[model samples]
Target: MGLGCKMISLEPPILCRLPPTTPTSFRTKTIVFSSYAPDKGGGAVSTGLPKAHTYTASFKTLGACKLGISWYPDFEYNAQGGTGAGTGSKVADDANELSVDFDIETLYIPPLTSSTTKFLGLPLPTFLKIDIVPQLFQGNINQESGKVDLEFLAKFCFSVGSVYKAPALLVKTVLTSDESKGKIRGGRGERLDEEGNCKLVGVAFVEPIHDFFMDSFLT
Candidate 1:
């Protein structure tokens, strides 16, 4: 028996419909980004505020008086209000001035002992000892200029082995990159340099204590 075969056309319909075209204005849009992109020159683009940085330093000071006493202070800058971990903000009016905080507990000063301290090329007596404990350290620094001005507050404890112990002498001063003048002492400081070295100077007045020993010693 012979079978009949049917032919089918694959051409599209003559009335085929096309989707409507979008308006010229609607086809393009302007997008705004909170951050800017780098320029064609390939320069860096600032996204927002600058970030906080931590710094460590060892500060040393030598007296110009007769005793020739010296101090070695080691400290670390937290840059986070001294509360441990976090980023710090900048001053409201100055973007270059960054608020800094320091870890007071980390502040250390070598005791005036025979091994660590000397006086006029002579080793200090073992019986006499002096220690410094930082109470407060907070200030602002110009990141771009490397200028620093920090308010430093510390206590100087004096003791003579088992013989006597003096009350802590409160010392407060503004350690700065500029000059600091007190009633009896004054000095100048230097700004931070490319090697991260800077000199901070401050003069603090030693007030008389009510105790007889302190008054006599200070006088």
Candidate 2:
């Protein structure tokens, strides 16, 4: 008999039900500017140079979200939040400043794709992992509005069967927002107890994949 042929269909990613007690938390960090002044033509090298000032602030309990007993399908990611102190740097010409680091834990893609309608008897490689990690985020912080504007480029790589793709640039301008309040499982505002500690929902958004290399790998 000649080589046999078979057909296999691939489905899209479906929303799975998460446990009611799925644990998640959110935290807000604040950078406050206490004061500022412009150089009154007083800099040794240049006039109208910026002058330094003093500022102090802390992140209080903005809000939190907790899920009770319910049977709802949701996509949940486990994220931990806690309070700690770290030394930060600021230019001599600036007031208060804050620094933070961001990490991309995973890149999730919906299961189905146009090219993956059906598989013939021929075999194919199994995809193991695809990751895009950025080194640093560059942006400005608006203390008054409690917002941070940042961007970063993503480095991409993936493993398929025994072969691993070399890392390359895949994405950029991964902008994020934290100015809005967060919602819990039930879409309720975060609740605060007598103590300042509050448990809030953590949120992260993934923008469109830009590079064709990334798109091919995902599909």
Clashes of 2: 5
Which 10-residue window in model 2 sums to the lowest lDDT? 1-10
Off-target runs (Cα >4 Å) in candidate 2 are: 1-127, 178-219
Give candidate 2's error at residue 156 in angstroms: 2.1
**Global fold similarity of model 2 (TM-score):** 0.33
Positional deviation of residue 198's Cα in model 1 after best superposition, in angstroms = 0.8
lDDT tens readout by residue for model 1, 152-201: 67676888899999888776666566665534344455565544344555
Runs in model 1 deviating more than 4 A are 1-87
Q: Mind giving the per-residue lDDT tens digits that candidate 2 earns over 93-165?
A: 4443334333233212212122221123221234544342444434433333333333444443444546545
RMSD of each: 31.6, 16.3
Q: By TM-score, how accurate is candidate 1?
A: 0.60
